[model samples]
Each structure stands twice: as C-alpha cells, then as structure tokens.
Target: MRYLPLSPTEREDMLTRMGLAEIDDLFADAADKLLKAPLDLPRHKSELEVERALGALAAKNLAAGAVPFFLGAGAYKHHVPASVDHLIQRSEFLTSYTPYQPEISQGTLQVLFEFQTQVARLTGMDVANASMYDGSTAAAEAVLMAHRVTRRRNALLSGGLHPHYAETARTLSEMANDDIRILPPDPLAQEDLIAQLDDSLSCVVVQSPDVYGHLRDLRPLADACRAKGVLLVAVVTEILSLGLIESPGAQGADIVVAEGQSIGNGLNFGGPYLGLFATREKYVRQMPGRLCGQTLDSQGRRGFVLTLSTREQHIRREKATSNICTNSGLCALAFSIHLSLLGEKGLRELALVNHANAVALAEAIETIPGVKLLNQSFFNEFCVELPGPAAEFVERAAARNLLAGVPASRLSPRAGLDNLLLVASSELNTDADRATLVAALREEAAR
Candidate 1:
C-alpha cells in the first residue's frame, strides 16, 4: 500500500516553496558510494504480496524463542507472560496519551504511578521516573542529572560499563560540552578509579555484572565518590541480574539507571525497551521525563496525575530539565505489567534460574580447547578469549543454530581484541544448549 503522506505535486510544491528543486539536492554531499542508482531489483509488490514475501523471509530466520539462545549483552531473551500483553492492550491504555486530562487519564496515570513505584522499589531508591526510552538514554540522562546536582561537568564512565551506554553518554556529553573521562575497556584490568575522583567530577558511572558479565565490587568505588562529594551513577543493562546481585543503590549509587527489557519487555529485535531510573528524593527535582503522583478528586476518590513533566510542554524552554518529550509509555506499561506479575519472590526465583543457567554454560565451555573464559566472576554474560576472531566464531556458531553473543571485535575492531568473544546464557537456555555450544567450540577448535 502506498502510504505516502504527500502527493507528487504536493511534494514538488512544498519543495518549491522551501526553495529546493529536488530531493536529490539534499544528498549532494552524501558519499558517492552511498548514492546508489536506485534499486536495480524487483518491482514493488502490493500490500498482500509484500506481507507474504516478508513472511517467507521471516520463516527463513531462526526464532530465539524456539532455540536456546545465549545472545545477550544489553537486551535479553526471557519468557514474557501472555497476561502482560493482554492487560497492556486494554481499551483504556491502548487509546490514552499525555495523561494530562486527569478525569479521562486516571487509569493510565495510575498504571504509570505503579510503574514508578515498582521501579523505585526494584532499584532501592526513594523515587523513579515514569520511564525513559531505554537504558542507554537513561544512563546519558543520569550523567546530565549529576551535572545538574553537583554543578560540575566532569563524568567518569567505568571501563566495565556497556559500550552502547558509554557511547550514548559520550554523544550527550559532547553536546552538553560536559568534560567526559572514559576508562579503557579492560575486562580484567582493575584500577584505582577512586583516585581520579575530585571536585571537578560530577558523577562516576559504572555497571554491575558489567558489559562482560563480570561483577565488580562497587563498595570501595562508591565510598570514594561519596567522600569526594561526587555522585555515583550506576547503570544496569541487565535489570534481572539485580535480583541475584547487590542492588546498585544499596552499593552507594546516588542515581540508578537500568534497562527494563529483561523483565516485562520482550527482545523485539532491539527495542522498544523501558528505561528504569531511580535516585534519592533530593535528586527527583533534577530527574528527566514525567512522574506520576497520587491525589484526591472532587469526591475524595483516589486519582493519579502527571506531576512533573520536564519536557517543553510543561515548562519554559530554557528552564526544562530535559527536552526528551513523550515518556516511553508502551514499554513502561509492558514493564509495569511484567513487574506486577513477578512480585518479589517471583523475580528472585527467575534471577536464580538465570544465574544457574549461566554457571552451567560456563562450566561446560571452560572444557573446550583454545576457548578461555575471560571472566572469573559474572552473573549471566561473560567474555571468552577464543583462538580465532570472535565475529568469525559467532558466525560459525550461528551456522550450527546457536546464537552466540556479541563479539569484542564488534565493539572495537582495532582495539587488538580480535580473540575476545562476549557470550551470554540466560534462563531460556537448557542443558542441551550448553552442551551444544561446548561441543561446537571443541569441534571448531579442532578445525
């Protein structure tokens, strides 16, 4: 179906009005290699044909749910309950937006309120926002929040932090002109990060069950930050790991941000993921995104409303804390539903299952020749130093129907880490899957 919003003449007229002759004019500076001579392929298909063709293509791909997928770095593969989807699709939530209309948006507001509460409790903080786009953005926002709270601009990102989250932080920092210090990505290189702490530092960002799945003792680091009057920003891409490991907040994090994808959200390709952010009550005022609060209506009945909206619609352009409008509503809703289903006991059990699966996998893989398990401590995901290129090894594993995780080379090709492979095993993996990966590694090494 041609869903083009503008007609040919409409587009031409608009372009003329804007003093542009053609769309190609906008691409004049584009790389010559990128300026392909349009598609020299098949003709456009009708809607029905398009659907059938896409379905055929999709059928050729392996479904992670159907296999024991051990591919996690940021996003995770977990069993999402059917009820979460059903509840999220209810007419009240499906049609709502903004939640500014208190009378009509009560249900949405209440759901968001509960979501915020669960996030705060889960992260062990005083309060949490309704949500952010995902973990990376939340990490970047946390850096900004720290800058605001400390009136300082320097941010020290731990070497163990997720590369994607670190990159996102750098992107925002470059724009904010915030001084950024990044520790080198070293899976086993433990350094005196605290010694770097000073008055110029706004916050120190670190991850637990870090990018390589190695867990770092955050106590000393947190203590140093606190003593230096620097805020500790903890980023957790694997929120489920929190149930099994120490809470980042309890470890002395002033601001805790995490990816809520592992729990209530499915790994739909890459996203739409919910970002969970939490912090002390004093820092709430500097928090980005919206916040839901409970109040009373005219009849003294319970109600919910969007109390703190830092985006442009709610505040002066210059005074707003974040221009990140439109909180991650649907993803947040999915997370809320999932978290509600997990309760306290359920989450802990699930976390235990994940850890057990990972441990089982590590033990099996350690026996494989030329495949060195790089992490001695981890929760679910860990890095392995392979005899060959990690990307090549992952491809070989994929050919054998195993979704071996991200490769270190994919993170940095020139970083001289070609032999490094990042692997993950989640609750979805079975004993057979662990055996399969180990056997495959042994066979590949023999070749």
Candidate 2:
C-alpha cells in the first residue's frame, strides 16, 4: 500500500550515493516559493468525502449551458452530437497513442490519416499533419516553419490576430532571437498590412474573422507576401468559418492553421482543443507535428504510416522542424468525427445558421442605446463598443445569471480597449438567448 517503496534508510542511502543530504537538495534549482509553499488541501480524506468536497467547489461556479452564454474569442460553444462523444470513447480511440508501429496500429493510424485529409481538404491545402497542441501553438509553429522555409527570421503579426496567438509566436520567436512585429489591434479590419511588408519579413500572419470578428481580406496581403518572397500564414480561431467563406489557401496562404474546437470539441474551460495545421506540398518537410500519409502494404493492401515526424524524438534536436513532443490525437479524432458527420452540405447549412444568428443578434444590439457594432462583415462573431467599460457590464450581466462575452481588455489589459466587447453566436444560440443579452446590455448602459 506504500506508494513510495523506499524507507527512511533506503532514501538516505540514495541521497548519500548522489552526494546529497536530503531530497530537497534535488530541488535546489527550483524556485524558493515553489519549494517552500505547501498546497492548501486537506491532508487526508476518503474517496466519497473527497468527491463531496470537490463537488461543493465545482457547484460554486456557473455552468456555461445553464446561462444565456455568449462568450467566444478563440473558444466557441457549438452543439456536438451525442454520437461523436460515444464514438470517441470507444476503447480503440479513447486510449490510443501515436502508433509507433503502423503495421499493428492501423486503426489509430488510419484515424490520423483521415483527420489529416479532412483538415487538408477543409483548409484547401495539399498536406496536413496529424494535429498540433492548440490553435495558439500551431500559430507559433507556423511562424517557425516560415522562418525555416524562407531562411528569414522576421515575422509580421496582424493586429487582429488573437492576442494569445501573437504572444505565443512572440515568445517563441524571441527565444530564437527572431524579430516579430505586431500591429495594434484593428477592429475594423482596415489595416494596410500590404504596405507594412518588407523583404526581411519571413511570414505574415492574418486571422480572418479576427479576434474582433471582422473578416479580413487576405488576398492583397497574400499577394504582397508572395511578391516579397515571404510566406503567408493564415490563422483561423473558428474553423467553422471555412464552411462559409473561401478557403485561405485558395486566396494564396502558404500555411493555414486553425483551432478545430468549433467542429466537435466543447470548451472545457478553454481546452483540450484540436489545432488544425496544413500547408502546400512544397513546404511539407518544414511543417511541424507528425504527418499521416496513406500507403500500400506488400500485399497491395491500403495502409497508413507516419510520413514525417520531425520532432526531437525522430530527429536531431537542432534539426527537428519543431520541438513539439506530440499531437492532440484524441481531440483530432473528435474533430474528424464531427466533420465527417456533417458532410459538405451539412457544414454549409450549419455555417449559414451561425451567420444568420449572429446577424440577428448584431441588429438587436445596434438598436439598443449606447452600443455600436464594429464589424461590417463577419461570420458568426463580432465586436461591439459600449458606453461604459466592458468588464463592468460583464459583471452586472453575470449577476443576472447571463454569461456575457469576453471584454477586449481582458485579452489586452493595457490596450485601452475596456469599452470593447467581443461576442459570438453559434448554432447553440437561440433567439431568446440573443434577446436576453441585448436586454441586459441595454439595462447596464442605462445604469
């Protein structure tokens, strides 16, 4: 019943063998606060008692589905079919890891292959990897891949790119001594990114239905990047937008990265979400994450194998395309399953419903006093400028049992955007829910 088999004498022996006096010596490099602070948790509890304690804590927070929820920035709330959950829980998928040997792991390998194909087709790219950690990490990886392909170290981040994604790319680029230029947030999608392009820039990242929900016209920026021999990295936080709009790849994006959570995954307080990464065939070797490729066995039987796995485990640390350890296998499976269920026609119809719902909500908000719409063209999400600080309005709404949208200041606290709120609508949203949000905002503004 002893988790730590070593007794006091055995532990002392090991420490002595390592020329250390105690186990704390092993954590000498850790921060003083980390080594000193004890967790504020009960020292002991029975299984049922622990469950009851945790349940009490959980009940203190409001569930998303219980309120008229309208939150969306990178994460969204879409109805996932019960069948998708049931299928992913199948023992073959729920517990599978990356198949080391493809011969015996055909089921998992094929699932990955299908996932890759689905992503590639959806993104209008020639190739796609299994998946990335999430949309932000994928954006960071795409920037690195551009650097590798172009032999340049400078990246340009659109003002509309999600702050988290921009921060992720900036941190990684800074570590490599690469230059990353980020424009100020442009809620109207009017930034002249083409004029900002230069020969030194390795890639240009633009997000459509950007953080503010203003759909960006990436064609001109893509042309500019191509003219300057710079790669164009297009980011999509709401992957469902692809169903309604022209694929970014079709508009000249060299690399496309997206958060596939909108398709099948739920916002489990942010993650675990699927990161969809795809690119043109010419840059496949430079792409990060594992790639699943279809092949034939000796018997001419169809098979799936890892075509490329440029990670620290498979290649020299310095030569690996990405230091990323693994992919979001289970999340990817869920995404694939959801998209499969919604064939091309079903996806388009779903997208149309999302757009219509958002438009109706925007119209309702616009009619209210002291509120202004910021997007002229958007898919399912948009921004609204309020009379007072968004944080204050959100708190007031929550008190009335309505979960309002994210405040722009929450993402960029110092950007002087406290009056801005980012809101989204999906198929899950109903007319009544939209009405509740508008009435709450109107009352908050009047106060």
Candidate 3:
C-alpha cells in the first residue's frame, strides 16, 4: 500500500492555517492554461509488465551512435573518454550531496573550486559560479542578474539566439514583468542588433555560432552595448568552439553563459547537462548559483569553501539573487574531470579536429545539387538550405540509415525556415559517416 504522509484532518487543518480552502487552491496563482487535467496513465502496474512496456517504447528511439548521425542544435555528439565515466562513478564523487558543511565536504568543494577556475579561464572572465541547471536556465538567470545590475527591466535578444533559450528567458522575465524583445530569426547572422539598442535596455543577448550554426562577431555588438550602458550577454551553445575561437570574455561580453555539455558530458538523450556562467569580478555578488573559493584553515592548511551562495535557500528570499536551489554537482564533476584530462593544448587540438570535420562535411554538401551552405564562418556546425522542406529531407535521410541534421522548423516552427537545416560534426564522425551523409543528401537532391 502507498503511504500517505498526512491524514485528511491534518491536511485540512494545515490548509486552514495557511488560509487555503483546498489543495487545488494552493495552485490558484498558476495560469488556467497550465492547470491541466491529470494525465491519462495507468495507476498501477506489475514490475515485470512495466519494464516490458518501457522497453518496448525505448526500442523506438534511434540511437545517435547507431546511425551516421549529424544532429546538433544545442546538444552534440562527442567522444567522451572512458576514463571520465570511470572517475565520476567513484563513491565519493557520485554519492556526495551539496557541499553544505565545508569541513566534511572538502573534496566536493575543491572540485567545484577547480571547476569554477576552469570555466573562468576558458571563458576569459574574472570569475565563474560552480554551475547552473543547464545552459538555458543559466541564460535566464543571466538576464535576471543583468536587471539587478543595471536597475533596468528591458532586454534585447538577437534573432540568432536559440529559440528555446529565448523562450526560457521570456518565461522567467514574464514573472518579473520585464520587457524582452527577440528579433526575427536570422540564419545568416545579418541582423543589425546595434540599431535596436537604447537607454532603456538592460542587456543584449546573442549566441556565438548561433542556433543556425553561424559564427557571430560579438565585438561590434559589445561596443554598441557598452556605449549605451547596456550589458552584453554572450551565449555559447557549443562550448567546444571556445577552444578554437576568441573567448566571449575577450570579445567584451559583460556576462558569458554557455552549455558545457560538449566537453565532459554526452547528450544523454537531452539532459543532465552542465551550465557554465562567468563574468567580471565586480559582478560576482550578482551572479546566480554558488561560488567556491579557497581559504586557509586553523592550521594554515589550504581549504575550499562556499564563498558565495545567493540562492533563496541560503538567504532570505527577497535578498537572494536567484531562486535556483542547487548546482548540477555530478554533471559539473564530470565536466571538470574531462577538462582536466584535456589540458589547454589538448582542448585546442580537439577543437581543431571538430572544425576540420565540419569543414569537410560542408565541402561534401556543397557538391550536392540544389543545396547551399549558409555560413561564411563557423567552428564545427553550419546551416544548409535545401531545395525542399528540411523536415522531409531529414525523414528521408533517416529512412536511408543516416541521421542528417536538425531541421530549422523543428526549433522555430513559426519562423518559415522549413528549407534550412543545422548540421554538426565532431571527432567521432568518420569519413565513412560523412560519405554516408553525403550519399543520402545526393539521393534526396536527385529526386
């Protein structure tokens, strides 16, 4: 039998004390659209039956590694060192909770401190937090932080920003009743973001090697925002690009937020990914999540501790910089381990391989009839315009045992980008995989 924590009378008494009429009343502030009927799912099932049903459903998924996969919009397919998995699974790393009491959590705290240093150095920023839930949420938190810093409520998001990231920021900003302006989708990275800036704007959000896979020059936008007293927030969906290209911090981004999944983590069928956030030292207090720092103990021994935790749980709700309760600890540990394995030189070399592979893929696709490469510059991903709907071409490619790429419409359904597709390549993609992808595209074009 299922255990019920509270009896009817106790629940009614608690509700009455809280001035709520019923359990449903507790969710009264939620929007009517969000308050949907309960899902039509089985209330009970035997363990064996449930396992069989789930296995059957899981069998339908096309594993990324099983085919000639090129799919990447945000999440990417990378070669994670077997050692990374082995190291993170150790009892101390896997079983540890938040480093609440630093005395007993030295190992976890030191790892986080190192992770912060790596992210700050990688992004060319003054400091970095331990981690955030993921890239999108880090971005939303960045906007909120900007609002707090500039004492302004308006934010301008470039068209090239990932649609999901934009939506995430929008949802958070709506609650605070802030103004967020997102430009039209620009696959070619041709939007004039400077023209949209004004004194009322708090920040401008732009993605490098943006959603369409075009590498953007944030310098001009950065200069513009600086002139307007606006914070320039740089978003990196593909963190691998940082090794080969100029770091966002060097390019004058007042704030840099990135999805660190490409490094030490796999796509994992979408999540348990890592978020990297960093900024100048002056804005450390305004940063979300936690900051791990080094200190000297009673005997003068070096120790790590939670230097700053501005979340609601650590302080008064009104005084907290963010409501985010915890960091993505295990995922962050995996990322730290992977980066440790790949020293600075190693990361750059790996990045070069990814770029070389993507360049080869782009060259192959250019040879296909009626297909056009959309990016003049990119790191390891780019957009291509096909003769027909991109979604239909993707389906056809899948039937031919090749996972081509992400169709633009899948991410921005209402943007009229049906003919565009986002393709990515990494060290794991071999000549055979590229050839297979090319052959499939050639077949589609011939039709």
For every model shown, what is its TM-score relative to the native structure?
0.88, 0.90, 0.88
Clashing pairs in 2: none
Candidate 3 residue pairs in clash (backbone atoms < 3 Å): none
- The segments of candidate 2 whose C-alpha lies over 4 angstroms from its true place after superposition are 1-47, 310-312
Q: lDDT of each model, Cα atoms only? A: 0.85, 0.90, 0.91
Lowest lDDT 10-residue stretch of candidate 2: 307-316
- 1-447, model 2: which lDDT tens digit per residue? 145588999989999999998788888877475547568875777778879999999999999899899999999989999999999999978776678888988988898988988999999999998999999999999999999999999999999999999999999999989999999988778788989899999999999979999888778888888999999999999999999999998989999999999888999888898899999998887888888788999999999988766544466577787777788988988898999999899899999999999999999998998899988998999999999999989998898899889999999989999999999988888788998999888887787
Please tell me which model should have the higher lDDT, number 1 or number 3: 3
Each candidate's number of clashing pairs is 0, 0, 0
Q: Per-prediction RMSD in angstroms?
A: 6.3, 5.0, 6.5
Task: Select the stronger candidate by lDDT from 1 and 2.
Answer: 2
Question: Which candidate number would show the highest lDDT if scored against the true structure?
Answer: 3
lDDT of 3 by residue, 1-447 (tens): 135679899999999999988898887777585557778886777778879998999889888888888988999888889999998999988888888888999999999989999999999999999999999999999999999999999999999999999999999899889999889999988899999899899999999989988888889889989999999999999998998999999999999999999988988887998989999999988888888989999999999988765445567576788877888888898899999999899899999999999999999999998888999998899999988899999998888778899999999999899999899999989999999988877877778
Report the CA-based lDDT of candidate 2 relative to the real structure: 0.90
lDDT string for model 1 (249-295, tens) is 78888999999998878888888888889999988888888889888
TM-score attained by model 3: 0.88
Model 2 deviation from the true structure expressed as Cα RMSD, one decimal place = 5.0
Candidate 3 accuracy as lDDT? 0.91
TM-score comparison, 2 vs 3, better candidate: 2
Candidate 1's TM-score reads: 0.88
